[model samples]
Target chain A: MHLYRYEENPLITPNDVPPHHDGFEVIGAFNAGVAKFQGEVLLLLRVAERPMSDDPNIVKAPVWNPETGKVDVYEFRKDDPRYDFSDPRVIKEAGAERFLYLTSLSYLRLARSQDGRRFTIDDRPFVYPSNELETFGIEDPRITYIDGTYYIYFSAVSPKGVGEAMVSTTDFRTVTHHGMIFAPENKDVLIFPEKINGKYYALHRPVPRSNGRPEVWIAESENLLHWGNHRFLFGLREGKWDSARIGGGAVPIKTEHGWLELYHGASDDHRYCMGAVLLDLNDPAKVIARSERPLVEPEADYEVNGFFGRVVFSCGALVDGDVVKMYYGAADTSMACVELKLDEILDSLVKV
Target chain B: MHLYRYEENPLITPNDVPPHHDGFEVIGAFNAGVAKFQGEVLLLLRVAERPMSDDPNIVKAPVWNPETGKVDVYEFRKDDPRYDFSDPRVIKEAGAERFLYLTSLSYLRLARSQDGRRFTIDDRPFVYPSNELETFGIEDPRITYIDGTYYIYFSAVSPKGVGEAMVSTTDFRTVTHHGMIFAPENKDVLIFPEKINGKYYALHRPVPRSNGRPEVWIAESENLLHWGNHRFLFGLREGKWDSARIGGGAVPIKTEHGWLELYHGASDDHRYCMGAVLLDLNDPAKVIARSERPLVEPEADYEVNGFFGRVVFSCGALVDGDVVKMYYGAADTSMACVELKLDEILDSLVKV
Candidate 1:
């Protein structure tokens, strides 16, 4: 497959924003929602703030000490079996629930661009984890345009697990949080471009049962809040390069081929890459064709080494004509963008 | 995952068969049709045969010499880029369908035992590749017993691609081939034990598009010959250990929980292992539950190093009371057996 890399790759870096805590860094800076608002390219970025220490020699690490109502340092060991400091996303004991210490806390940051190249980011986080379940973070924001309203779907992670939540804004400053549309342990919630057969269609990743692999499911609703007709769409690849896990990335784009979607794939090693699949426009659950090779991989220094290594995660992309401008998180530390001609990518896909 | 190896490990070895053909190894041997016939356990094994040569200079090894009408041999190097002999089942070009050299030739072989322990194997091959498309070999046979008749489903391979074929035998001696049931570029065909909702169901692995990952698809039939209603059942796990490829191993067994089935998984490294899944009894296509960890893996020397290493393949298993006797091929060379208490195995599965 012919691949294109940005000249100024690793466009976003770890130093872009300082961490809120001492032991973590700010990561997962992505465009949660994007649209032409007020005659400008507006982007809602999910900037994740995590603990900042990478050294194991420093036994004590800073954490949000709930009991003390302040950030406190706790002592752990380099060889501690209970804590897996090696993993950037999760840390846990053998029997305990996996906890994420560092995540892109749901703060809807703003960015503006004229040529869609250089973006000027807002100084403050736009949105924060308001609810108890969202104490951990909010992540992977997908923007869907319905009528004149812009709906933002993001992942809300907490002790309860990750769930899909939506918030809408007509004017950037005045936003209306729409509560959780789907249950917990759900993410990658992408709203279909338009209503299907007079019903709102959305693609969601729900971990229906604990300890089981997560799969893509579809739900329909008369209104956006109450969803029904829950049907399983896709599951993890059993014994292939993608056998590890998968998640919804950018919002589904409607094209002549179908609902084109760019998705992220992780192997057991947690190396993240991006691929695409075409879903039947009428029936979003029906997969038309999918790409055999990943559209984007972790090849740059920022992508291969950071808060997390070998990760190329995207939660939003903007389609202009036949080209798709994708903004992604590299190594969970910085943001980057790559452009692909939609027709060329679709043409490279293998059809069954 | 807690794994238990058979006490009498490596219960079957390559030396069990005659060694005249310079390692006429028994590989891809599956339980095709097992029955309590004439006071003995009759098993149809799909034994894969290949000549063994120690030479490493000549890269292109001939499997069958058409001019001489005999099996031919050649040499292959581990460092050769044009041909990769790394994969045991398939050794294809870097990104092409052309294979390096034929390393295995599959044919059906018969074995019988009065006590399900000590067995007697027939010296002659029962089924061999007949057409040009099936010149490579046949492998992974699944048998279904319906109305006092035995029907066998197996993979037929050639330069064209791997496809599923059917054959029937009532008394072992008189066999009738049913030609190809599925088109080329497919394998792991398994027929449901009985009709569901007045229609026959079968599970097949199809690579409908080249270079794309394989997926499980379901088909329905009225006469068990012409199948329709072909629909997607499941895809491989993305970013997991078994995220690469998956295929049906043994025939589905009827249970109160659902249609219990043992399936095989391969990682990107091509290590094959066994797992179980439950499908809705009434709707055989709906997956009810699946095992998170593999029930069996290649650990022993015979299982880790032989004609192919790190492989444990199965096509047949017999349930007696609450015990399931799994007959599997180890390291693509010998037949081995493992006894699993049905309820214990079910306990390990993730219920959905």
Candidate 2:
């Protein structure tokens, strides 16, 4: 397997993007959904921000209150036995249900690049948490340019549940909310650019409470709204890189071999790596081949350390001739890119 | 305010209904969804059956295996620290996600009555746990007869999540599944018998994990398969008889004033009672009035004792002129009926 790492490795850092609100600060700028528009590559960057806090004993959780139309900070004392803030990303209340609050709220911000290298970040957020379903804020946007509309699907978190929502834009000016397509405890959904076998297909990772682990499942839809015929596609490899959980990464790229899908997998210790899965062209639910080893792992200095460490999560990618331009979130902090040869990736896959 | 208890109470008991499979016993036969078809009263009973395990240290959980099309038993040792069987109904695993498996699996069995008092329980299940979503079992069904078709909405539970699913039958011979109408962490859905203002209305209770308690919500649909425009209807009352959690019970009865809905409410200590809520005729989402006190509480010995004590949950009722024939599940073990005056219920509700 061959990977060409960019010299300007960490393309867009948290310092590159400014916060949407006054009291908030940019914590992470990564896991962007990408597309090509108007001769420039567009990145729907997941910009995470948090309230300015100095006290070590106090934990501040920022949430977009739909009633107030602004961000509200919920402060919890570290000494409180009712709340657990051991996980830096989420605050869990001590209960059977385990009420969760995010440490930082995320929004999708637009970033433009002419050569798919140097980027200019937007001042305002492209898509902010607007409804009660997204009160905890949105994260990990995956953009699929279908027909004339750019469909951006992201994880909408709230007390209701963690479900996937869709927002579409035709000219990058007006946006329309399509509500929640998939129900909660589910995320990392990627819609294919085109329909397969007369029905729209999507790859989703449903976090099961029991029986099975979090695995990639395929669903079919007629109007891209009401989905059914859910089938289990594939799961994590036991005692391997993806032994813990796995999810769909970038949208599947169509090639002569099959539908090539680059997916992210995590080990037991929460170390994320990217791998590939190839599916049958006609019946996308049928697995054809899969990656024996991860194509991209947390190896770079940027990937090894940041807001969160040892993670390389991809949301979108583009194929140019025989080269695949893949953009991923490193350490859950900043955006980065790596180029992979299509032929080499096809050869590396182990046939199912 | 007024209730006429049937003299021959506990209409259907576990002993009345025989087990479908060998080496199994009917533990509970309750929560019957009522309907009148061809001058006969029909009760879709939630019959819970479990394996006859004689060993006190061992617990056997029965699951409908779709692959083998047979009931499979999963045995767990009482001394196993990995599993918690203190609830007696559910076996929870020691994990953050809290994997759950039901102690006894339930399915809908048809019970026919000529006089709405004496009934004949079916030998086989009318609607069993067929799919993976209903692996844990289908419970608490609410039936609504609209345009010559009987629509039965019930809770489908599994490791995936607890969601509301729909099943329809015209003659009770052939059944059709409409898949999951609502996503996980949701149940207790009751569809109105008739459309309101050219749209179908449903009352559902979504179990929120973080912000709100389990509250009743209203949703509208055109095709009944895809639902949207979800709005919160009402929630639990503090320091009241119905304080813990509330959910829609039977199909709403349409009257001149409004649509009268009988609902079940539980206390913090798990004492279930029946209450009423009146909604506007044209706009069913608007609350007109609600019961200040429970119309039916756990008063009888059957309701106060059994498998699950102090529970009086209703699923269906029939309106005959000014008198309403209500069917309820007593203590999650047996079914019972009560006669309620329509005008008395409307008068008892406190205006909003």
Candidate 3:
């Protein structure tokens, strides 16, 4: 895989601007979405911000107060038996509700570029959650273009569950929310380029029956709102490097061979990397071929250790002529960009 | 799934004959292995014998030529490509060298009880392959146990890949040949009384890959030969039911669930089935909660239709405790058998 980075690496960082409220440290600024709009490159970034406190014994985290429709912060002792402060992502207690430091709500920020490099970021957040369900944060935004509509699908996390929601915008500024497209406890939703035959098709990660681990599923519908004919696409390759979890990444592109999709997978150790797959054009449920190698990984410092470690996540990409521009979050703390030749990536796939 | 039986239900059925060539048809009914000690219930079947004819038109219908080690059949009126004279159970021409035909041989037969229930069969083959690739025409045959070392699996085809082969014997006694396992190039070999996690395990069918159709892949591997991975575990489900092709039938016995299997599915049309998988203890692969599904299918079928069809097939089930019995034919002609157990089948699964 060819990776072309910006002359100035870490295109987006924590110091670029404070993510949320004051007195909070902003980190984990990584790529959330990347697109070419009106000749200018646009990037949606996920910035992890946490409260700045000096008390060594105090651990404050954010929690959605459904009753109040506001985020609440609670402080727990470092040695509290009920709380597991060992995990950097969340601070949870055995029987008590889980929470992030109230100062940690994430919002999407915008960054614009002219030559697909050297970006200028906006001071304010481009999007934010308005209700308690999304009070914790809004992360991983993926952009898709259909006809003349630009659809932005993102992960909305809250106490209820991790769900998928969509927003459409023609000019970035004025956007219309499409509510939640998927039910709670689901994420990694990627819609196909065009309707198959005449029905809309989408690839989603569903945790069925709650007993088995997450697996890929295909859903179809006449309209995007009502989906049916759910079928299992493929499951995680057991005993392989991606034995843990898998999710959708860049929007699927229509190709002569099939529907080319870039997806992310994690091992038991939580090392995130990107892979590809080709699906039958007429029946998106059929997998034509899949990649045996990852397109990207957490090799840089910003991608190795940060607010979290060993995470290289992408929410979007732009197809320019024969090249693809991908923007990804590295180590959960910084944003980076890479260029790949479409033909080269496809050539790397392993046909069994 | 609609099932069509020949004019004879349990067609080419099982019969009780003292182990001997005069008593049955085709033979040498067993998978390749050396665990041949202990009492084994083998099938003795009849090997179909067609007298030579002098007429060129009648002689042109596929005939197993032992001297040349290939089927000698004439393509009358080569100009009209849509000719359909060969057996539907096998033989078809897609294009050029891609001709699909039943690789007929001999077959393996089973023993039936006077009560139409329990039965005692021979332990040796009444017949064996006349050639190399299949020095053993022995095909799929299912087996169940009444006591110790009692096992059976059959499917006997001819070495010339034209007729069926059946073989059977007890304590290596007067062997009997029942006939062929099926016709030729046909297989979805299955044995029932399914087991798993300390139960029985059966084998079944699934089609092979062709013109974009799917192929059969087995799961169970207790001692390494017996299987339980459910056939048709992967394939394309288009606009029509069984649109892709499928095979293998009934189900195997394993613990609580019984193992169910079938042939592969060719797209719109094409392909063949074979192989097996394991099922749950009480539920069987039929319940589907524990088993994967369809472990095999026809990738090669001689007579999938006509007097036969896309080849490769199996039927009948005999169990010896947790051990399952399976019988099947290749290209619709030859037969063979393999023994498997519930514990062994469950251990071979690549669980999701």
User: Which candidate has the top score in lDDT?
Assistant: 2
Q: lDDT per residue, candidate 2, A33-82, as tens digits?
A: 99999999988899999998889999999989999998889999999999
lDDT of 3 at A125: 75
Q: What is the TM-score of chain B in candidate 3?
A: 0.36
Q: lDDT per residue, candidate 3, B1-352, as tens digits?
A: 1122222222222223323333223222222211123344333343432223454443223444557754454334433455443442233454322233332334343443342223344354333443322432344434333233324444433222221222334544345443332222234444333234653333333211111122232333232122222322333446523445554443343344334443334436544443343444443433342223333343323234323345444454345686554444434443444345545555544343
DockQ values of all predictions: 0.02, 0.27, 0.01
Candidate 2 wrongly placed segments (more than 4 Å): A94-100, A207-213, A229-238, A256-258, B94-100, B158-161, B183-185, B194-201, B205-222, B228-245, B255-259, B278-293, B347-352
Error of 2 at A86 (Å): 1.4
lDDT of each: 0.68, 0.87, 0.54
Off by over 4 Å in 3: A64-70, A95-103, B1-352
Question: Cα miss at A286, model 2 (Å)?
Answer: 3.7
All models, RMSD in angstroms: 13.1, 3.0, 20.3
Evaluated at residue B282, the lDDT of candidate 3 is 49
- Candidate 2: lDDT of B28? 93
Q: At residue B174, what lDDT does model 2 achieve? A: 80
